[model samples]
Target: MNTGSETQMGIIPPLFCIKCGLEHRLPILIMTAITEQAIQDCMTQIRQKQEPHHSLEIQKYAQLRLMDFAPLLGEWGIDDPKNTPKAKPLPNVAQAFQAAELSAEQKSKLLNYLQQAAKQGSTTAMLYLAYAYAVGKFIAQNPTKAVECARIALKHQDYRAARLLGEMLAFAPALASDVLQNDVQIAAQNWVKTHPKLAQNAEQIPQLITQYLHNPIVAKFVAKQKLQQAKTMGSPIADQRIRGLSMIGVLSSSQPARQYQSIENWLENQLAAAHMPIESDDDMMILPEHMPLMVQEDDDVPVWHKAAIVGGFLLSGAMITLLIIRFLVK
Candidate 1:
């Protein structure tokens, strides 16, 4: 009985007004029926894939698998379409950096690409540019520019940049007085404003700054601090920095010596309880010789526990003395 747009079963009925039972609208009626053949024809057209021209499109396609578009492809009835155009691969930050040794024109081209990517709001590109500026890699070192780039990334809500900025503020002596004189604590305070949980305790600010100062970036800063102090003051620990970095009253502690001693005692007690020798040779008890002398400055000390340095010495000394007394009696 159905003349137009027949499904496998039958023609679909047109929507009608329930109360009036008015005759069906022609356009609405026409739209009601969709046959299997129509679906197949629509799918055939969708399967006729066209290649993309834009570089961004190509990059996006290459980075994301075709399967990611499965839902859209399915809806369009496109499957296994060929000749999906791929864009030429852009060199990553590392590649571009290494290619700095190439000819001037080539390097310049690469730098331009990176700059464009940064301008386009690529956080990765911004970070690489920041690093290049910070370390003088393939470009004249400019810490100010590096900091600026890092700040830009932070504005974009990049947590890596936030941590990096923290490191720069805490460790970089070039920035210590000029930029970070009061900024470290101020920055932390600002951060705490939004992330209120970080400021739940009174000690959180100092604790957070301490963690930042312990980052790998601060290693160079700590070493430089030690060297400068050793040359001028002839004492490494005499300076307040080794006590722990402080600015604007955050991370400033007067009792680092006592705190360090307590840590040393706790670590020694733990090791003694375990009966583990402090060094490879079980007989040696001279803790100072075995333990590193560069305590405050050295960040990469082999001992995992900060207290272990002093604690190991005391524990080893006590053990050796006991052994010596036993030998003398024998």
Candidate 2:
């Protein structure tokens, strides 16, 4: 419905137009807001137009609307010549990222704008800049600088920056060596301990350590602390090492199914030899089909002897009965 917001500053609001209806509200506002002289001139121009000028006239009206709302539009960072640019866009940094697809040159320009915003202490801008640097998107990879920027962002209680910083410190290979040189593991462990939430991210550290340990040049450094731990706690450390080695072997083996089956078979055999029911061996287990049978016999007839007599009688009787039946049939 047409409402007061749709009306021009001074004129009474018009009924909805049949052709364009409610869509013309802003245009109507532009029409009314223009000076009377401009309106007269516009009317004259339209009257002088021929059939070919309809599209041009519509374009002119659109341009006029833009010009009339230039200040408000510019305030939203819209750069239309008719509108003013907003200091920041709605939804702030998120909109800038969405516009990253505009063009390489445009993205660079946006980066500069975001930098200015960051300088003015926009936490969102700082965080975005850090992300751009961290990933080397539109900027060279500068993890140290990214960390610095992220730290500043975090000062403003930006959880996104805190999370990113924690992640970068936890993983990023470019920073790993320097971090380790500075005893960063202890620092990270301390951070995780103090911030219980960050501790949950500790899983990422083991992966980085594994990566480091796989590198021949860096393996010694990676193994130093683990070796110390293993030396200090013998059996528990040995068990952990065994499990770790087994997992690596399983993962690295080409024939995973065969390897798993072998492991399962070994486990089952071990359990069976130990007189323990093999409840399960990784995947399947043995289950009894029925209750175990119990054997009993009178004292006068030893159990074994009684079972043998029963078997002999049944066999002989079956043979004799078969002979008799055959004779009768003949």
Candidate 3:
């Protein structure tokens, strides 16, 4: 055994630290049998000391590795805490496919990964895959799949998915399967009931209405519902549009000439009766002969002031006319 090489020593098994779940390979072992609680306490103290460094590492990884997905997530307002290794993790399959830098093979691989993730019940992955299917990003265009993904997201409480579903139902109803048609209708009806209270919500309502107007399956109903909604909201412009849409069939038929004329006349009267926009204080410019034009500081100018100015102008015009007439007579 002592022939030439040094005598071999037994190898020690790695010590698994229970607290931090890391294995420690020590070259030497102290015979002292430390309690498991003592080991855990020691590990916990070590981890506490290393927490800041670990956080720094995670932050660096997210900032450096996930820069591409940052803007995309910010746009969606998705909350992605840096607690996990994933950053701004949302549905980005379509975005990845559409990126100019990815090769065909890379896109294929990425798509496969996304599909797997989606199937594993990743809501964000599903949403992204749905859009990819809808637009035929890297895969063949499949509206059916897009609708399915959107429905799944909606079922999972993604309100934005409901919006996508509403849009598909309203603008491209033909693309929906017959089995899903009634479901689409029901979803759309529910969507119409939404009352927008935020700035973003208000902005999205008009887009939804536009899609509803294009829906061949329920154009008339959509228009009618919008008309009522706008009226309740006190929007004159919306009222005008809905009324015009309702008359499309009547205006195109000679048999409904009277109805068309009646509707036209009513519209005209409505427009005439609507008040003109009053000039705001900012818009009201008053100029004195010797000074620069001064905008009114108050929101409203006195009605009597306007009346007095008009009367003065009219009186001056009458005086000029009377003098001219007298001179001609003379």
Candidate 4:
């Protein structure tokens, strides 16, 4: 009933079309099926092999397996099987970055490959090039170039690129004043709406924008607004902490006196809460002697104050009166 050749040249013979009852030269279909099957087989073999060297061999074999479909894909006018319009490749930039720790040379080579592919109009490649440039991976740092590449990728409906580009435009200095910022924001919002899972990462984009691009004034306002929203919505604390720290760092760097006062006030309040007397006008509380012994006290003081008491005890003969009062309250 079936007379198709079953050789191992990695080719699947044409099959009869059920609708027409006639054989169709669907080489692309057959090629995809065969290639996928071969890839799976190779992966299975790699997984089953116990030897590390054999596993490496299997990996190499798997990498090259796609080459077998080149001729068939060529006949169907598909030059890049992995990056064909119908078969957009997966994002590999993150994986490449993770590998950067192990091999700088390999990372460079991969980035070069991505750049080349991007220049050839591969959306996925463009996205990766933007990511690589944004992070300065194996290349000179160029946020402007990264944003440009991302825009091009976004034009091709590359949502990942759109998201990253949106983040960059929102925060990166290169596109700070450009109209592309709004475009990027809208695109990113649309993407998150479409892919609900992306919403989690979406919240961080605004912070990233503030960190990388916004002026000090704008940064402070955005950070304050985000912190307020975070407090009310009970958003992820880690995210809020990150944004808060960055904002505080910027504020401290730009406004030293004001920042110092804020810190001092916070410290004073904390010390008062612990019933510790303000020791220094500038530094707040004094360290006590015998820190280990102070910490060994089972009291209801905040952990930080307890640690401070222990540190104070270790440092000098600072009056233990405040510490005693804190314990009394407990």
Q: Pick the candidate with the highest lDDT.
A: 3
What global local distance difference test value does model 2 have?
0.41
The most accurate candidate by TM-score is: 3
Each candidate's lDDT (Cα)? 0.41, 0.41, 0.42, 0.41
Deviation in Å, model 2, residue 33 alpha carbon: 62
Residue 240 error, candidate 1, Å = 25
The residue-by-residue lDDT of candidate 1 on 267-304, one tens digit each, is 23332333433444566554432232344765575655
Name the lDDT of candidate 4.
0.41
Model 1 bad stretches (over 4 Å): 1-91, 169-171, 177-330
Each model's backbone clash number: 0, 7, 0, 11
Question: Which is the better candidate, 1 or 3, if ranked by TM-score?
Answer: 3
Compute the lDDT of residue 136 as modeled in candidate 2. 45
lDDT of 3 at 316: 100
TM-score for every candidate vs. truth? 0.30, 0.28, 0.32, 0.29
Among residues 3 or more apart in sequence or in different chains, the pairs in candidate 2 whose N, CA or C atoms overlap within 3 Å are 70-83, 70-84, 74-84, 74-85, 74-86, 75-86, 77-86
Q: What is the C-alpha local distance difference test score of candidate 1?
A: 0.41
